[model samples]
Each structure stands twice: as C-alpha cells, then as structure tokens.
Target: MAFVGREQELAELAEALQRAAEGEMGRVVLAGSAGIGISSLLDELESRLADVPGIIVARGHATEPRSALPYAVLAEALGDALASLTDEPFKAVVGSAAHDLAALLPAISPRLDALGIGREAPALEAAEQIGSRVAESLRGTLE
Candidate 1:
C-alpha cells in the first residue's frame, strides 16, 4: 500500500537527487523518535529512486547492542559495495583509502589484500579517535 502525508518530505528528497544529478552535492539526514514511520519513509524513498539510473541505496542497521560498535552499521550497509571494489578500475582508485576502511571494517582485510593494499592497522589510538580519514575514504569510495 502507498504511504500518504509525506509528499513534502518526498519532494525534498527528490530535489536533493536532482541537484546531485546536476553535479551538486547534498546531504539529507532523517532522525526521529522510534516508531515514527522513518522506515516507511525510507522504503518509499527507495522505491521512488528505483527508476533513476546510477542510484545506489545502502541502509545500515543499528541494534541496541551493535549500535555502540564504531562503524559497524556502515560496515553492514556497505559490505556488498566494499566487496565490489576489489575488482575493476575501482581497485586503482582505492589505494590507501583501503587502509582507512579496513580500520573500521576488518572483514574487508581479505578484499584489501586482494587489491594488494594489505590490512590496515587498528586505526584507534588510546583515546579511540577516528578523525576524518574514514569520511574521506567513504567519499572516495562513493565517488
């Protein structure tokens, strides 16, 4: 069944995608209290994007226990996309960003090795800092 009462939200997402198509970068974050229909909204959003070429939708889940794990949600969501990077021309572009990702997602170490990049050492310090390298690497991967 179709969801109603979110035309405004859907329009905003559509506009963001249109800007992205025009080479403009936009970020959208949806947050709300639990059981407020966020998933329904995203399901509708994903359905709407299905007809658009060059669109990839990756969603991460954060359970109460898993939520505390750094980058765990990202690892889950991007597991397939990360695996795809081991092959093709993307291998050349990945370079050291492999280190950045491997720091957060250890399961990709084998994939990184396949790319000849080797495993990234644990990225956290005694203080457990991640900084911006992961974000940059994520952008590189998405681009």
Candidate 2:
C-alpha cells in the first residue's frame, strides 16, 4: 500500500509470482537508495497476489554501504526458499549446505557477515563457483 509510483516494479513482481506458482523459482533483485519504495512495491505485489498459489514471499533488508560481502542478500533469499521447501523430511537436502553456501558470493560477503555468516572459507572466486552450483541445484528442484 505504500507504493505510489512503482507500476513497473509491480508488474515484474507479479510476473515473478506467476512463474513461482508454475513450479519455477522466480527471483527479483531490487536495488536502490534508502527510502526508495522497494518494500512498498513488494507489499503491493503481495496484496495483489493474495490468491496466487505456490508462491512464497520472503524479505530481508540490507543496509546501504553494506553490499560488499558475498551472497548476503542471496543467502537471505535462499534461506527463505530452503525453509519453505523443507516441510518434508526428505527435503533437508535443500538446506544441507546453507552454512557453507553463505561463504560464496563476495559481492554480498560483508552483508552476509553482518547476518552472522562471518566465515572466511571458500574465498571469493571459489565462493562464486559454489553459489552457481547451488543455484543450479535449486533450479533443478523447482523444475
């Protein structure tokens, strides 16, 4: 309801939610300065999607000037995915590497550390590779 000027963002979010309902993992990365209305857009989309099936919404906030750590934002998003997918005991694999996965993706590393994943392993390049592998795995599950 806080969205007053985000028609484009709303459309994109609705599209992603539709994809998710069709058994796909839809990801949207919204980046902008503080107080830009990202949260408002997300809220509006959820309201519009109230009856949509199989689409789960998870949110995390990354403070400005803290986007350097690898996979910080991604980790939060993935954590949401894993948690939702883990209703079945057999789906524990979805979250098996969560801890280590946080180490990958340097762009969000500083943010990840702030979220309590302050590990130094896997390094940056290696972390990226690992993150890609995990993304592929997640896609496989959604497929």
Candidate 3:
C-alpha cells in the first residue's frame, strides 16, 4: 500500500533509527484515534528499515483478552528477538539477570542455559524481585 503524507512522522522515525545506530537509545510512540493510520505508519517504517543492519524490530498488540498478562505486550514483541540471540551475545547482554528474565519470558530459557546461566526456579514468593530483575535485564538488552 502506498503510504501517503506523514512525512514529518517518517522523518522523526528515521532520525530515531539513526541515533539508535549510533549507540543511543531511541523511541517512537504513535497516538491517535482508531483508523487514523498509526498501523500504516508503522508498516511504512518497517518496510523502510527492512534492510537496516544491527537493528531488530518486533511488533505486538494489546487486546482485552490478553490484558491480564503481566508484560504481555512486551513479551510478545521481544520474545523471538531475545530468543534468537546466541549464547555468547545473550550472556554478554543479559548476564546474570537471565534467570529472572527466564522466569518471566520462558522463550529465552533455552538460551539462558546455553549461556551457562543456571536454571534455578524462581520462588513464588519472589515475584516482585523477579519482575524487577527482568525489567533491568530487558533494559540492558535494549541498550
């Protein structure tokens, strides 16, 4: 589909991608009423960045059915990307925090073990601690 207008939004996305390539964190948020081309803008961005090196893109949506799941949107978006990481790089990026993340994101568990991160079960009583660790690990991975 031809993406019409939104030149300014596309330019901002391009600039954010450039900064991210330069080792800086970049973020873009789209907000609008339904059917206003937010998804179209994202689709356009994805197409434009399809061949960009050293960047990973994942997409997810939240709906009423999955709203009860903690970090459901985040997990859906990042699970595959995180799972694709090889043992060495995964360990380098996630380090000791993999254990906690594994609890939250089971898709990454195999990679965690491949990195020699122990597979100890997180105690049920430690939900808060585990959540904090997972968030920190995710931040480190994105940086």
Candidate 4:
C-alpha cells in the first residue's frame, strides 16, 4: 500500500538516516499497539532507503519463546555481521574482544575461535558484571 499521512514521522526518520550516513549515531524507536502501522512504516522506511550506500538495515523479531533470552533480538540483528567477521580483516578489526561475545551469542563462538580469540573467565560473581561484559562485547562487535 502507498504510504499516507505520516509526514512528520517520515521527516524524523529521514533526518536520522542522514545523520547516520554522515557517520553520526542515530537511533529511532517505534512503539504502538498491534495493528497500528508500525510494520508498514518500517517497510516504507526500508523502501525509501534502498539505494543509500553503506547503509545496512538489519531487522530482528522477538518471538514469545525467545523474548526471555537476554539480548535475543540483538543477537538476531547482528547475526549476519558477526558471521562475516570470520575473515581475517574483520576479525582483526574485532580483535580478541569477539571472544567475549561467545558467552551471550553461541553462534559466534566458532568464528571467534577461528580468529584465535580466547574467551575471558566467566563473571559468576555478579549479574551486573555479566551485563557489562555483554554490553562491552556488543559495542566492540558494532565498532
């Protein structure tokens, strides 16, 4: 369906995309009740940005069963990117930090190992430490 009547929302999304294209961090969140047009808006956004260079649009869905998993959606969204890090250049860019992600994202373990990155000792003492490690590892992956 043709998009209609979301001028303000589209404008905001465009500005955010432009900033990201210029190497600035941009984030957007769309929240609403079911059946509201969130999906449609995202589809429109994807179509609009189809030709923008160096812009990757990764998407992930949170299902009922996986919703309880920590960083489930994040792991899904970054799955392809992480998989691509198996090559030497990308692995070097990620460095040993990629191994830390294995604790949270099992799918990355083999790639991390191939890079000769060893895992850090598990942070069993506190939940906060685990969360911090996960966040740091994710940041490293994104960088």
Best by TM-score: 3
Q: What local lDDT score does residue 112 receive in model 2, on the 0 to 100 scale?
A: 44
Q: What TM-score does candidate 3 get on C-alpha atoms?
A: 0.75
**Number of backbone-clashing residue pairs for each candidate, in the order shown:** 0, 8, 0, 0
Model 4 clashing residue pairs (backbone): none
For model 4 the TM-score comes to 0.69
Per residue, candidate 4 scores C-alpha lDDT tens digits across 42-103 of 78888987787645555556545575687887777677555544377556656656655676
For candidate 1, lDDT tens digit of each residue in 20-100? 889986566677777877789889998887787667666666645574665776667666555544375457656667777
RMSD of 4: 3.5
Q: Alpha carbon lDDT of residue 11, candidate 2?
A: 76
Model 1: runs farther than 4 Å from truth?
62-68, 72-75, 80-86, 89-93, 115-130
lDDT per residue as tens, model 3, 28-99: 657667788888888888788778765666665654457567777777777766765666666776666666
Candidate number of the best lDDT: 3
CA RMSD, predictions in order:
3.7, 7.4, 3.2, 3.5
lDDT of 4 at 35: 75
By TM-score, how accurate is candidate 1? 0.70
C-alpha TM-score for every candidate: 0.70, 0.56, 0.75, 0.69
Residue 62 displacement in candidate 3 (angstroms): 1.3
Superposed Cα RMSD, model 3: 3.2
